[model samples]
Target: MLAQIRSIDSNFGRTNGGLNQNLDSLPENEINVKLSGKTKYTDYKIISHKNDTTIVDTTLTIQKEYKFNFLRKDNFELLAFHNQGQTFNNLAYDFTNISQFPDIGFKAKLFNYFDIEDVNYYQVPTPTTEIMYRTGLEQGQVVDALFTTNFSKRFNLAIAYKGLRSLGAYRRSLASTGNFRVSFKYETPKGQYAIRGHAVNQDFFNQENGGLTATSLEAFVNDDPNFSGNRGRMDINLNDAENTFDAKRLYFEHTFKLLSSKDSLQEREFSNLKLGHSFIRDSKFYRFNQGTATTDIFGDANSSGSINNKTSYLLYNNQLFIDFNSKYVLGRFRVKSDLSTYSYGYENLQNNTVGITKNKLKGDAVSFGADWNGRIGNFYVNASGSITPGIGRLSGNRLFGEAFYKKDSVLTIKGRVGISNKSPNFNFLLHQSTYNDYNWENNFAQIGTHTLGGVIESKWGNISVDITNINNYTYFNENSKPVQFSGDVNYLKAKVSKEFILGKFALDNTLMYQKVASGNSVFRVPEFVTRNTLYYTDEWFKGKPLLVQIGATFKYFSKYNANAYNPLLAEFTLQNDTEIGYPTVDLFFNARVRRTRIYFKADNISSFALDKNYFSAPNYPYRDFVIRFGVVWNWFI
Candidate 1:
């Protein structure tokens, strides 16, 4: 089957290849008779913003199971709420994957937002379609569908949409979201000119009940007999509150080769010089609505009748770069310059008695950067840095570098270091809301961060460790106000993963350890987190037409101070009164038929047997025992 095409170099989804490798076991005639004669999996390519290419993977493995969720990614470091499309409590943080500039800061809603890197372009030998469907919390379902086709050998087009709607078990806990994307890529036959672009629109809506009330939380935590059967009767803090977030973006990049070698077969010290340009326009809106304000919970509000607040952010960016190759540089180097214009704020100026007067923050920034990629035998070096001039909100500097050593396909090692200095998110700098306690304007210094990390991947196991130090860290305190820490924060994180197989049974384990060397009062995380899965795999029937996998996963974490979700601000705030930690068990049965994979899961089965003390946050109870079914299907035409 064409579905069995495999890429030569693959680590999960990220791949690199200039050559194609076929499945030798398949008969020669079977492969030649396929459409386009491109039967290898590598022929179906997915390209990232950085132009890294990976093939569509149809194999069913334990890693695949971990990624089968609403996010469609492994959420090992996140604790999900009771329903999908809702906010998550962070279990860990990665300082290395930070943006160079500040952004519109409704972080809780950004989880479902698709960034430039999250969007992918595709090239396939035939028209290909993928559909993912899954059951939701109570009253809805989720469907993500994508279709791509190639009109010619050098041009491709793709469209995708993911939508979800669910009415959760808790009162007023309903979530609905939709994301739409269209992407295309084109190249000239001579490999001298190429272009790629994409357009995306996404919207998120959630009905917020503000979690359970004090009595309700006590009853749920104590497993009171009256509330044991039905959680709907529990009292909540808010009855008619909801929030929505919407975003739209358009992006394009084009490149042209100014000079090239005449001979394709001959190796040269200096070969190619290319010029490229990229442009992006993005806009975002966030709105909160409530029928009535909860004065006791959120303090006094400007208007007691109802609350309606909205914030808008707009950005335009243009970048130009030149790339060249030379023997002195070893591989390739790119030097670039960028100009960006941004605006973030509310519609009307707020001149309250509290002295918060600004309606918006608008400015333009100019930055210059360079990137280098070099290889010496099996060792590779990649480094990049950028600096923005002037004392504007977006003015900052960032430097990152990584070195990799690969020993055949058996083992690989990588080391990385990063340093960044940037202002906090826009919301921290200036925000205006109907609630008196929510309005703020402050002049804060740029936050500085430094991170050092290393990773080793091999057949025996996988290990990664990172140490990060931060100065002028910013956070929302228990009072729900943005505040910068006066002290430095140092953190260390380490993770190890391994899988042991014995015949048809396998046991996979992942363990993570985290520590706050300082600044624990403001920065908090659990000391230990773990997930272990034990599964049995086998083929069924005489022809082995079906492959089956049955497994149970055990996950747990130590008790620590977890942040609380605030629907009004679409953010998480510090909470020290309640410590949250729990263990959960999930059972799954999966099967693969042709290019389709089916999934059935019993989530949080431990809730039916253990104490009812599990909480996703301070007052948000974890999901109870629920059975969910889903399927992922891919078809090639």
Candidate 2:
């Protein structure tokens, strides 16, 4: 199925893919078929859908998802919710996977509350099934399953589900999430008509233990000589605070050919004109509960500890699109236009207990946008733009363009820039938390961002740099309150990665540098972050069927005041006074036997032998020293 276009109006929609593995490169067999067939098309594997001849760049290489590359690549950065789950890092360097839709410029996001790694769309060639399960120290757990089958050469169906439960290393910090998706694709034998659809449901539950309430940080950071290892003995801010966010979505789209052409010599046919329609319905709900211990209030004068607040939002969107493809001066060219309308906002809400004066935000808009992709020999370029004039007080937009060149497999260089103006997510704009330390609705302003970046890659290693400027930046402040800045903010980031090899020994290193040029008072980032892995790998056993590698990675971040996570709001907000830094090292051994992958790991190895202040967020401590083992197996049924 083609990668369906995600709308900004859809609650629980996807995010930007900057830190994700580059999905632009097609599989070897697919690339051969595309060039030989003299035609190009888009599929679900990549984040974007295209219909022109574009070279798939395979030069971008990413390390395995199991390791820690500043948490963006880690399997279980925070409490796991599969891949792309929540992570505790500075907001300035946080990786976003969600992209804004060209339609009504609005989104209902709970990114920190739930994560769905694979994006739930792919081409299933045959009947296949996969089952995964993992359990960690301190009552941590995970379970997942997937099944796909081809009913016919032109039709396929897939269903996937994931469940997670983690009683965090600290007391009263349990988190659980459940996600399920069902997808289907069908195309006519002539490839003139096609249809794709999917239904998804995701739910997240977390206990809001408001970090440590101790006045002095040392009370929780240091360990006494006689103290045994019991994490529950530490004091926490709030134990009764709990929150849950849930999303349900049903989507369907179909397209048909309006004009067609065929080549006599090559026995090839193409659709020069096509029309399509799509429908999506998404519903979201956030609930928070607190008991008696919350009576004595803090943080705000109008709030108390014991409270109950819950709210729900329902959205419906319909879209129509036209696509054209042919040869033009710019090379093989394709352009597409879309028109969409949406109805969204809260249908029902609780009282002042939720902290917002308005119960619902409802509006509709007519949005249109276009995209073009072309290639001339080895050089290629693509551009896209979208806008809305604001129908009844609702408006937002996006503009993006990029170009790249690659010389065979040895080296590649690319650069891109984009500008977008998006309204803050509905969840943050109106949050209803029970904790006295968490509750908000201050009428946040819209956010505009301008970003420019470049990448250089080769067999030896890769280097990347980015410069971003933000207007009206939005975030949670030190008081754990949601707010927006009116001043322009600038962020500079650069990354370098390389590996040294000698015989069977290899050392992989990655270093990142970040700086806040304008709004340094609110925009915070670590000056330096580094990760190094030292390991040995070789083949052993009969016929060398088993391949094993053992290694240890030292992860370090320069001392900085990392933003703290608020469970009630499901966001990482600024914490100017909460300075924390420590080295977190992990030791692991992994092996691949046939198609199965297995690993045994010791997380936070250094913490087991020394007394150091190691915090994942401001007051929350990193996972205690623990031993873990897990395996992944894929099957074709």
Candidate 3:
């Protein structure tokens, strides 16, 4: 089946996951061949919320190695904790993607949360299955399985589940998580009407040790030989504490064409007039539990012996839109209006030493937006804007525009601009907890941000640069309280990536540079970060049945004041005390046989030679030398 798919991919007319196909590239006989008997690589499609589609990629490359971790995304700008399912420390920040409304802000525990846009629909000619497995820290593992198929040409369904559990290498650093999702897409034979929807349930739990104690921190830094072999013997600040974040979501959208064009040629200039309706309901719960609260560690609590605090958030959104194509508009234009209702906070009011805090924050907002996509000469332009009028909790405005220019497959250039104004995350405005020091209610001003960025992609390399400016930025201070910065924050980030291949030897390098031109005391980031890999790849055996890759990747970042993690609130706080900087190396051996790709890795190999000074954050040591293996396999029927 794998060989047949490859053959069809090479012989048939292909598209870049778009509606248009260049039949001129294929021979007459190839076009006349019956395509229903075999499934081409392009036949398996993944569609995003924005209607962009891309085929499932099965090639084994270094880029795949970078995304094979717990989050299944590139972590070039993040530093992971000791465990797989735990949270990550940010090495850089991006403000280009702005939200119009405030969020339930337990940002730390939300790393594993699957948002509505993250869910994807699928269309396939045959049943497809993919399984991904990887070994975890000590006692557990991570596995993600997916199955999707089309019952008919116009209907499709997909189901996927990802679960993880790891005991970790430290005393109280275990993580467990599960994510389940189901999605379906259907349309009429003439494509005048269509519907797509997805439902998701996800939960993330972590055993919080409150990091290491003063003694353990000193011992680990000094490389105490007594406890070098068994890290679990080290003492921590808290022994019996855990936090969990879970969410449930249901979303669906349907569209129908009120009028359609009869001529195929005229469809390019004028097409179907579509009226669409979308609805979403999302609810989330967060809880923290501690068997015993140490007053010295977390201060006085409502119940010192045992503590439990919970918070909930629920949101409902309904949007109605209309889209059409006309010669005057060039391509397509859409106008939409939506109403959103949100409730976030505790259910009951709390009166503590600090004061009395409100029980919840609830409100509704009506928003309007427009989107346009068109082509002028050799340039393609896309723009969108949205606004929520009146003074409400969710009042905001956003304007974004992008332009792209492509020259065959050799080079491409893209530029973007964005400006937004919105309130900070909900937690910053209102929060109540069992710990006296964790309770607060404040009214902070809106945060305003402007971003300008551009990217250049060519055979030589890929380069991107972004500059962002912010006003009234909000963050958690050293005291773990929300505070808005009084001064402007200016940040710039630039990155470059290139790959060089000579025969079986290849070199891939990615470098990033960050600068805080202003607000240095409030905003912190490493000045330099880099990753370099040198690998060798070749086919082995008689008929080149097995493809193999061997590589070593080295990653490093400059020392800076990295933030500290607070388990009680599941958030990172500003700290000026500890600066973390380190260099680590990973060795990997990967092989691909047909539809199965196997991976073997020696993670943090440099830890064996270098000093044990690496830390993900203050009092949180990075992972030690470890060997792990995993495989990703796919099947088509």
Candidate 4:
């Protein structure tokens, strides 16, 4: 009885579940359920049997007046969605598709490995489901689905699936991909321990038509003005080639408090001594197959090597970290150790009469790393470094640091610098293509790169600049053979995005300028690229219940000798002959009604009307002028 009196006297006693039995049970036993439906009604004055005035109300009449820009998806990350410098079906902002293969690099040759953008999984209390469907070029279609739910406040699970199938607009061009992911997050009620994990499997199958034949490309450019209209009739270099990239991965990270925070009961803070462990097991397979083998097209085709080539890679990694975070200047610090084993290359061949041993690699490496990050007032800084100790030939060493300052949403700035010295992909060192067009065994030195970049953003717009220097930049030359540049190459790139809104009209523009300060002979980049949009927005009706927006986008890039793509190698190779550049125009109208959004767009509106050249990749023409319609509906069920 005395305890009850003490608890009742305090306002927080209701939440303490102390001696108040009735209050404690009542709070926990109550359940919440909700549902909603809407309808709209119109009233007419009977003057000429037409409605004169319109009024919208939430209680009496539901209004379908929600409105949004049709080009909302093209707002900021437009560069990525555009895939400006890549082949069709490729991701954007991936102009440089070249990177050192992972230490355990075994996978089917890939053109879009660096292009895939993984999902950002989140843990939430409410259940969420999102479904999207889209049409492709010809017989293409995209379907996506994701679902996340929390069984308890401290635990949640999520699953996501995606399927893409595109027959493409050209002959013998097609792609089919399936991606599945499952993830879970858990935390202790006391917030002392937590774990997050995800497992993903992706299968990408692409038909390698080897693009169109040279004569066909010539006809497309000069001989035939309406070539794009009959894209299905174009002659291709190789029609039987197909590449499949398959991968599976499992990752998990868990952290447990080593020392409890002093305010653990009253409040929770991540600042404390903690121990963490992470594990990863990943594998990849890449295979290229051709039904009718032809040695004539690819030099080594008929030479005892069937037109089937495959590669596989496996990796197992484990990491441990001891971390400390404190409010007192120590901010946060982490000491980490990693051990990984990798196996790559072909295990067995269907036929290897070439008298060559199976090109294979297997190794183990151990690395040590440390990192620190802290925030002081309006400024924040972070730094990290790692080094490998004679575990494998690959030098897994890296150093990076960055600082950021932000006063409010209006003024924000960030600068970062980093360098990585790493070995080339094992596949790059010893590659065997069943097709004779490409075959090599390179003994190249490890490459290193230094990068300095900064970004500034404000209410007006944002700007970013970067400077990069690469020693021994690796790339495929005109000969379709992988080569490393001996000298250092320097590149400077800057991008700016500015938007002006006056009354109901708005204009947005983004421009990128790139320069090769040195080693122009080896490095390549366009001089300039830009995208601009002009739009107007307004609302109608007495209640302004209906909103509408219409806009048009313009994209342009300077003419340059864009790299040619080799389907067999899944690589973009240097080409000096053809320079591709042209301006593209698109018009769009988008609207939101209630919670639903609909968009209509006409891409490449001036295609045949203009002789401008538009190609996603060499010999691969861009999509012709076409109109598309799409809708997005969100449900909170």
What Cα-based lDDT does every candidate model obtain?
A: 0.86, 0.59, 0.84, 0.62
Per-model TM-score, in order, reads 0.95, 0.83, 0.94, 0.82
The most accurate candidate by lDDT is 1
Off by over 4 Å in 4: 1-117, 223-228, 263-270, 294-297, 303-306, 349-358, 540-546
Model 1 spans > 4 angstroms off: 1-33, 262-270
Model 4 accuracy (lDDT, Cα): 0.62
lDDT score of model 1?
Answer: 0.86
Q: Measure candidate 4: CA RMSD.
A: 11.9
Which of 2 and 4 is the better model by TM-score?
2
Q: What is the lDDT of residue 53 in candidate 1?
A: 56
**Clash pairs of candidate 1?**
5-40, 5-41, 6-41
lDDT of 4 by residue, 1-637 (tens): 0001111101000011111111111121111213224211211000000001111111100011111111112332222112111233221232222332254333223333322224333433346555555556667566667677768856778787877776767766677877788877677887678777778888877777776688888887773856646777878888788877888888877888778556567574545677889898888887878877755555656345347888788888898998787677545777999888888777664335444455777778888998776678767777778887673555557887778787656677888887777787776776766554455566678778788888887887889888888898887788777889989988888899888889988887889888888877767667888888888777667775555668888888777777776666666678888777778888877665544445677878978577736776676777777766655554434
What is the TM-score of candidate 1?
A: 0.95
Write model 2 residue lDDT over 461-579, tens digit each, in one string: 88988888888887667766667887999999888988899998889888888888998878877788788888888878989767787888887778777776665555677777677
